[model samples]
Target: MRIEIIAVGTELLLGQIANTNAQWISKELAHYGANIYHHSVVGDNLPRVVEAFEQSRKRSDVVIVSGGLGPTEDDLTREAACEVFEDELLEHSPTMNKIIDFFKKNNRQMTMNNRKQSHVLKTAMVLENSEGMAPGQIVEADDSTFIFLPGVPAEMKSLMNDFVFKYLTEKYQLETKIKSEMLRFIGIGESTLEEKLKDLISKQTNPTIAPLAGEGDVAIRLTASGKNPEREIADMKTSILERVGHYYFGSDSITIEEAVQDLLVQKSLTVGSAESLTGGKFIERIIQLTGASSICQGGLVAYTPEAKQRVIRVPKEIITRHGTISSKCAEEMAVQAQKLLHVDIAISFTGVAGPSSSEGHEPGLVYIGIKVKDAPAEVFHYYFDGSRDKIRQRTVNKGFELLFHKLK
Candidate 1:
């Protein structure tokens, strides 16, 4: 099917926020093997929207539109549908009742303008919006289907997932569906990861390999269209990971922190931390995951040398001899935190993360220390370039990555 996404709103044209609906819809429709040719953004003008609809009707079999379905005067999707499909507007009582009851439950007055949202095309099948006030519509005319959806992302997604997808699949008798497996990696740059998988990516056919880069992490998305698609994608992913398995941390939307948490639980080991540059960010990320309370003892934000000495009980001599940002101080902090918090393992981050240097060390200079119970403590040095937040985020991600490998 030739599908076109029309995003309606003057707000989108004015750059108030991104037209995320188009991006999300395109991805969702791709699962059903949709051929999306054109994506358009139209302002809240009646003539332009109608013209846009008519032009799309000439070429595309399916026209999916989002936005401009609201109570305000700018809401003109139903009006455009009436004009384009030559259908009269009909009052949908069930939708109005839902909207009225929503206002009653919320203890708000139902303005008369809200009635504008309760109307549907006369010959259209109503796409009910359970999450929001505006009801969506599926109007068919002249052998083409016009899907009128609310601009709000949540509303559009709900309608699409619940109704539109099933309808499209059943009507078109779709046989193939897109499936994807995302292989996540840390402690590697996108360029390095791409180079490692260059042959697999270049010579792929059934499942195409695509690389994605994010802050502190990179991913290879393996996508394919076929019967038993997930299994095929998984087989491709396993082949790719065989060569770079050490860098591959987890897969399919798993975060690096989640991977570390799983490793800690599997080993039944507890953890704690002492932080300087990241200021408890490492511990914070760990504790955010569910079941963290069982494995995470706690952490101390020992930003100052005095705090490191007094809180985590890092020896003052190490700080004096090697400076607070040195590897010696990092090792001492980890060793002391393990003893102080009484966890199986302790991690420490000490760095000069800044727009400027500190203690004669340049910005982005960092040291990560790890102390495993009944083992020797060690510290790793690194230099990262970015803003303070980026450097701190890198520190946290690197700490988890190192911890995962150490536990493994």
Candidate 2:
């Protein structure tokens, strides 16, 4: 079914509050095979809201409105909805009792203005709000469905999960199950990955491929529709992995830190890092994953030439000769960190992440080093294009990517 979202809040237009509710609703609705065609943001003005509702009813099967459902004077979602449908507002007894009980439990006095929270359209179905005072409304008019939800995120989420989803499932009698899988890839750009799988993407049918670029990585989603959700998801995953397995690092909801943690546990290895341009971002990510203390020995942020020489003990002569952004300096940093931390593996990152060059090297020039027992310390050089923060993020990911493959 085609759906449109209307976010009603004057604060959104003033940039005082973000419309996160609309984004969350869109994602949740997509799971039920509903297509979100458009998103509209309207102030608390009744006229504008009524106009938006009229426009949405013409092109969408479902129109979901969020916000402006409080007891305050500016809360006008119900009024606007009633005006659009030409219906009268009436008090819902159950909603009124809930609101009174909430105020009583909190030891607060209920004012006459609070009665407004219990009002609903005469022809609409009342949706119980377990988390907040303002209940939601669902109305069917002229073959179109209108859902009015509270602006509060927790209340809206509770109503959608407890009532709206089930009601829509029974009302529409939807049969086809939609399933999706996310394949995470590092060490490759989105454009390059798309070019490699262009042939498969062009001929997609039941299983479609979409690539999304994210911070320091790319994700490819494979979605399929069928009667049996399990079978459809299995088929889609198989088809995608067959073509992109080499670049794939993990599956849905699995991050690089989790994959690295699993690998370290399996290999019984400890790790340490000596970072320069990335400023210990790699180590910070590693430690954020639970159980990291089992494998992470320590880390050092050797950002300056003096810090590298004093902390990690990179030789002064080497830094003076090759400069801090050189591959040789990165290798020495990794080797020194390995010995200092007494870990099985150590990784280092040294680079120029800036709008200008450093030591005759251009910006976005990075060198990653990996040191492991029985193997010589290795360094890899790369040149990237982006802002300073993006370059630093890329350098950190490259460090982890190189270490992951080396250990594997």
Predictions in order: lDDT: 0.90, 0.88
The sequence of per-residue lDDT tens digits that candidate 1 reaches over residues 346-392 is: 99999989988899999999999999998999999999899999999
Give candidate 1 misplaced runs (Cα > 4 Å): 11-31, 35-39, 82-135, 141-143, 152-163
In candidate 2, how many Å is residue 64 off?
A: 2.2
Q: Candidate 1 at residue 11, lDDT?
A: 93
Best-fitting candidate, measured by lDDT? 1
| Each model's total of backbone clashes | 1, 0
Native-to-model Cα distance after best TM-score fit, residue 311 in candidate 1, in Å:
1.7
In order of appearance, the predictions have TM-scores of 0.86, 0.91
**TM-score of predicted model 1?**
0.86
Q: Could you give candidate 2's per-residue lDDT for residues 310-330 as a string of tens digits?
A: 999999999999999998999
- lDDT for 339 in candidate 2 is 95
